[model samples]
Target: MTIDTSDGTPAASPDRPATPKTTPKKTLRPRNRKAQIITVAREQFGRSGYHNVSMEGIASAVGITAGALYRHFPNKQELLAQAMLDGSSSILAILDEVDRTDSKVVFTALVRYGLDNNFRSLLFDQEARNLTPERRTEARAGVREVTSRVAAALRHERPDLSVPDSVVLGWALTSIAFSPARHRTTLPRKRFEALLARLFDVVRTAPALPEEPAAQPQPTSNFSHTSRRESLMGAAITLFDQRGYRSVTMDDIGSAAGVPSSSIYTHFGSKAEVLQAILARGNETLRLGLVQALRNADSREDAIARVVHSYTNSVISPDSAIAILIEETANLPEEAQASTHIAQREYIDEWVHLLGNETADARATVLATISMINDLTRVRLESRQCAIEDLAVRILATQTV
Candidate 1:
């Protein structure tokens, strides 16, 4: 029987041909199968995170039964851990590509390529600990080295900055590139640049950090339209973000969501299901935020402000998805990680599309927009604050200019 890979792609059975053509003399090559599973597994993990997916689910996606998958991996954890290994290798290739070059252009191009394709993200910001202990240790070791190299590159560019590489500052910069932010989400590329330029002027010219923390928002009151599933998800986000995903059990999620734990079986089979729900919901909210910003924007300038308002609201204000996404960074398995990445890509692509699909600068605009989000997230993670309206306006003005 043929098993589907985790990404919904079919993998042809190697033992036999569909047409009944006997090629018994053929030597089986493992590379082809390994590559196929890697692709599917990455898609699953990126979209779902770690705890939310199953090996059986991944096997089904690959067009193979879970029993069939056992031929390749000892168990689900092995599959996930190996997927992380393969994904990290792909990233190392990208880093190696530019290791010889000092040009920021190459760095920018690499970042641009990553945002456009969502491939590099598999490397720099993964949640791959769902693997078995033996494999997980190996995977984490590799991840640390890869991150160290990336951090070194960033530090190379910003030699003037006081923060050291591989620490909170480094993690913060990497976080910006991967996380979605408001000001970056709403405005056109030209206007967004203006916003960045203005911010830099202030950063370079100012004598001290801003005195106040970013503004606090009111708690959500729009549950009127939310479903039981969504309520569970929303409640789960609050709890998961507060207590951490692994520490919180399925029972806690069920109790907090006010749904019978069994309802989770109906809506989502496990606590992991609830986790994926939070990740997916975060992506959806960001998408909706962009749409709302566009609708509310009276001018190019205003558009950026609306986006900033949405992004800031989501990340800084105790929203469900933001912390959930970050928390999942170290614990996702192959199937869950890839799926989450694809979902986030779809959102970023929408931003790219917003820059005008046929525009010559569309890709650059999207990457630049992505870069802005990275910067905005940097502020939030480092200082733990952001000015929603101000950040959005600055990004919009820069891009417009």
Candidate 2:
């Protein structure tokens, strides 16, 4: 008589005394698979944004089944929360190890840490908003701690700067470091690090702007849009900016615009189409403004100033749609996202071309400078335009240095 083995092969005949069959061993996952999952999830979330990536997609990217992914993370929120927690913890640990007395030392360490873990920095900036309230609080607390530490370091180094200025400078340096996480570049790592260090020095030594009056709320016009399509577009941009694109629905938008939910389709095919239109319009406006600014300039410096002024004005206005363009672009449909990105690249390339730095390092520097100005917009400077323009000039000076 023959006995079947677990592998479905018949065992050796008993007459041969059948050397004992060896049972096949099941493959074991790496002990740190959970950590691995979080790492992969960070890259996915950072690249695709939180709303665009799915649990199954993450699992596939990690070479695991959806069931296995669940075995590690109960749901997407838990995974995102864990990723943010891990990233924040890592950044804090790096900050702790660096000497905080010297602003340069702290800033250099931050730039290195940020570049080495660019994906993690992107997670903190872009995906942290998707976490649950509790997790979001935890992440924000950690970031605030790091920011406070940097601010203290800035104060220690520059006793002349006011408390507010020091805090703003600290945030500025942090934004400079995180800038690389937002774009792609081919500059060598060491070269990029050196450029960032120089940029930090420029920011550190720059003269402070005079304080201005508090920001006054700009008056709004009472006139209403006669076109339903225009009204819907306006309402959608506002809602998309306030609540992320994923959270806003057609019905919600219709109510906000006073259009029937069923009629929204008559104007636009879907919510994604609405976003596409918004992005296209914003891109065109920026492109046209920049071209006009460049055309009217007499010299390289004049052109740079004009471009920076125009770009800053467009982004800083209360009614500016640039925020939606920046934050929600990743949530767009693939084809629309590609088109927007192409347009943005052309825009950046124009800046780099105009900067007269067509090399990879120069391109990277230009992008970083733009990023610094863009990020400073969020700081609520008293003299917003003057501060931005001064900082832009200072940032541009670093490329020559």
Candidate 3:
């Protein structure tokens, strides 16, 4: 009888090429294959975006056949949803053990957990967007539960903060803690943990948030829809931001811009070109911000502060261009993706060079600071409060620490 290996490959037999007599290699299929599948799926999904990864790729990584993977997950969507939900559940389990009342105790536990399982928070942000509306909501509900627990702990520690402020701080803490996952941080594990602890302290002692001011009116475009090409670009960005780039169609863009779908070709060759245009505009905006920040700064310290504020303003504003620049670039064609990535890297390098710390750890810390600020401010629409921007500058300006 032919024996099958745990990896779903059949053992070599006489019908195959003759071979020297040897024992068949043992494949230990772990009893907890489901857990292992989820773990591998999370890493793959986080490293490569949801659309880029395939079930076969994930199964191969997990040392199982595609058939075996299917037994655990019905489709890629289920894997995406379950991986995040399971990750959140793991965090919830950790929260259950800690003293959730003491903010310090809770913060320490969360930081340690985040360091160990860094990818969980990232999947919650980018990959969850690929899920169906109901699945996405279910996955996010788990994250909200984790956030609320931390916010409650903050309230217990500091009573002066309003409910909204505490919740904001809660999210800030979580974002800061898990930010290392977004970059390659080469810091000694202990030192990195200490850095996170200090950042939590920074937020912990921050002044109580003030009442939210009235919503400011957006600036009117000087040439609003006067040009067909510009109008199509604007419509494409909004659609891509609200839905993902893959889900938005050329027809959708044309309809939103008040043009015939075929007429979209007159201005833009394809959807990819439209996306490339939107990202190009965003890159130019950042370049200009950097220039202005440098030109107006009184000193090196002032330059860093100015840059941080400039970036925070770009991220916190209602404009969808920044969001598209950040999230949708992955869908661009290979050459376009490379160009966008190079621009983004150079932008970060400017800040690192400004800090005069070229070490890997410094770059990693700066990256985490920028990513934490962007993520914390964008998680909730209400999180656009000016106080969050202040906190963001505070976080990045402390890179010397």
Instruction: Highest lDDT: give the candidate number.
Output: 3
> lDDT per residue, candidate 1, 1-401, as tens digits?
98854554344478744454355788554667767776777667666655666778887888777776778878656667777787666656766777523423333433444454454343333354345567767886665555455456545655654443223333333333332221234445454344333433432222222234656796977548447777777777777655558768877877877778667678877777777777777778888888888898787556655666676666655554866665574455668878887777677665555444524234344444344444445333434334323433443343343
In Å, residue 45's CA in model 1 sits off its true spot by 3.6
lDDT of each: 0.56, 0.79, 0.79
Root-mean-square deviation per candidate: 13.0, 4.0, 7.0
Candidate 2, 272: how far from true, in Å? 2.2
**Model 2 agreement with the true structure over 1-401: per-residue lDDT tens digits:** 88854665556676755566678999999998988899888887777777878999999988999999999999998998888778767777887888979888888877888778764342235455567779878876776676677789888887887887776677677777877877888567888888888888888887774465578998889986599998898899888866779989998889999999789999999898898988998898789989999999998888888988888888886667787888889878788889999999999888888877677777777777777666667545525567667777778755542
Compared to the true structure, candidate 3 yields what TM-score?
0.85
Runs in model 3 deviating more than 4 A are 1-29, 120-124, 210-223, 299-302, 356-361, 381-384
Q: List where candidate 2 sits over 4 angstroms from the true fold.
A: 1-29, 120-124, 213-220, 295-298, 379-385
For model 2, the local distance difference test gives 0.79
lDDT of 2 at 19: 62
lDDT per residue for candidate 3 within 1-401, as digits (tens), equals 98854554456678875445668989887899999999898888787777778999999998899998998899999998888888888888988998989877877877788778765453237666688999989988887888788899988888887888887888877777777777665687898888778778888778876566787897886654478898898888788777778788899999998988768899999999999999998988887898899999998778887887788777766654888887788888999999999999899899888887776766776776777677776676444456776676566555653
Query: To one decimal, what is the Cα RMSD in angstroms of model 1 from the true structure?
Result: 13.0
lDDT of 1 at 166: 24
Give the 10-residue window scoring lowest on summed lDDT in candidate 1: 202-211
